[model samples]
Target: MSWLPNADIALLKKRAVIIQKMRRFFIQRDLLEVETPSLSQAGVTDQHLFCFKTHFVGPEISERKPDPLGVPLYLQTSPEFHMKRLLSAGSGSIFQIAKAFRNEESGRYHNPEFTLLEWYRVGFDHFQLMDEMEQLLKLVLACDNATRLTYQQAFQLHLDVDPLSASLEQLKVAGASLDLGDVLDNEDDKDTVLQLLFCVAIEPVIANDAPCFVYNFPASQAALARISKDDNRVAERFEVYYKGIELANGFHELSDSKEQRLRFEKDNRLRQKNNLPQMPIDHRFVDSLDSLPDCSGVALGIDRLIMLATGQSHIDNVVSFTIKGA
Candidate 1:
């Protein structure tokens, strides 16, 4: 019936155990647990992400109280912006297991609303952060040491193509083998092509027996990560995969406010081209970057982790309710 939870009692208990293990892992490292507001005046600028918007109505005043329509607010896609504000305020090395919402499709591995385990490590590069991520995954999943690869290496191994240097023609040729049809025909974004190839051809074939970390992504796809000093063509971004499931995404954070603003503007431009609504940039977050320390941050999917830990097949099995159930 509608009154019952989507997940069983045993799966619910297992989820609790997994979260406890995660908290213990962070606490031992001296990372403070913090919380940020779930709703905010501004939303993320990433064109790929969609936010759930709402309006806050205050107590009834006169018929005219300036703008009486109330202020538009958005449910956060992640706690990244607010948590970075805490770091700018001198909170060293913090973590949060927060409820994140996204307006997106739901399936075996996704829910519109889910729990995310996100953390920031001061004085850590993406590599160092990967080291910590490896330790935590081993402890929580009881899995073996993870294998590491560069984004280029992964594309080379799986598709026999270089993601960074491949021309649109070359990418389309490779994508042809996957029967992607016109998916890449009219698409001009190189990063979009690489992502389709990676998702359709590579992610499914990643090492499934244990965790595999693919790092040094193409610079164009570097969401908030810094471009690598050793290689200008790549950014210090990484993703953790296990059993064909993308478990986490991490970045060596970019600290330049100007560059961040440019990226935000670029995303809005892209949104305009694609007929999507432009998202308001979180200026407070941009303002905090001057004091933002050199660090690495990662966001892990808790429902997927629980699915792996408990041997459940779908996200619905681990979460209390899915969108339909809700």
Candidate 2:
């Protein structure tokens, strides 16, 4: 068996250069660089995400009768909760290039442990954030001005269906042509079906050369984004796609503590319904939401950006080590 880094020297050098450039780009924009804890007492409750759990042993923890294993700590899937806490604490406009972990399938585009470039811009809405994202893409990838579309428009343009107003039956009918097999038939959740349709039918066919920004996702898929004031049916969320890869996800953040908690509970309920593991909600993070500033935040996949920058096809080609190599 061979033991070597997945990335060669040239690829490693290119990766370093890209990171340095990213730092410079953010620094010039006056966003403060900050670091948050990678391990937390609670994990994300999102049904779509899973956390890597580890045990924390204190000097006296092992002797406790109630628990045989030390306190369970979870490796954060994203630094979002911690960063938002910082924002709540009055840290204005911060950014982080940090390691994030997720327990999931790892392959061409995904790594269990990967670098993420996340930032929050105070007082900016989703549109303003999208504009800044375009500028950054121009600087880093040297791409042309991206075409913009609402989530509804993207679906209509590509699949000739109205995602925002479509009934569950209508969406299922639209998705039927994809021949996605039992996946579509078995899914009862409208949001799940819409997400699958977006991934399978739309993502591959989007602009392959320049970036594309799809905004105003359905409220059901809002996650942490605020629902649109003008239209309650959708949220102020946006996602950036470039070279047929999803590069960034951003939101005009929701600052309601109560609403946030309800969302978390909803996610756990969904997890229970699906027989997936229920994650402990980070109460500390939720509590901080009341003080969180009106801002926009986004998390960009650094490894994928590096892959696009260096003309690499697989994630492993841009990182020093793959999961197997590690």
Give the number of the best model, judged by lDDT. Answer: 2
> Where is the poorest 10-residue window by lDDT in model 1?
59-68
Badly placed stretches (over 4 Å) of model 2 are: 59-66
Worst 10 residues of 2 by lDDT: 59-68
Question: What TM-scores do the predictions have?
Answer: 0.96, 0.97
Q: Report clash pairs, candidate 1.
A: none
RMSD (Å) of each candidate, 1 decimal: 2.4, 1.9
For residues 217-270, write the lDDT of model 2, one tens digit per residue: 999999999999999999999999988899999999999999999999999999
Model 1 misplaced regions, further than 4 Å: 59-68
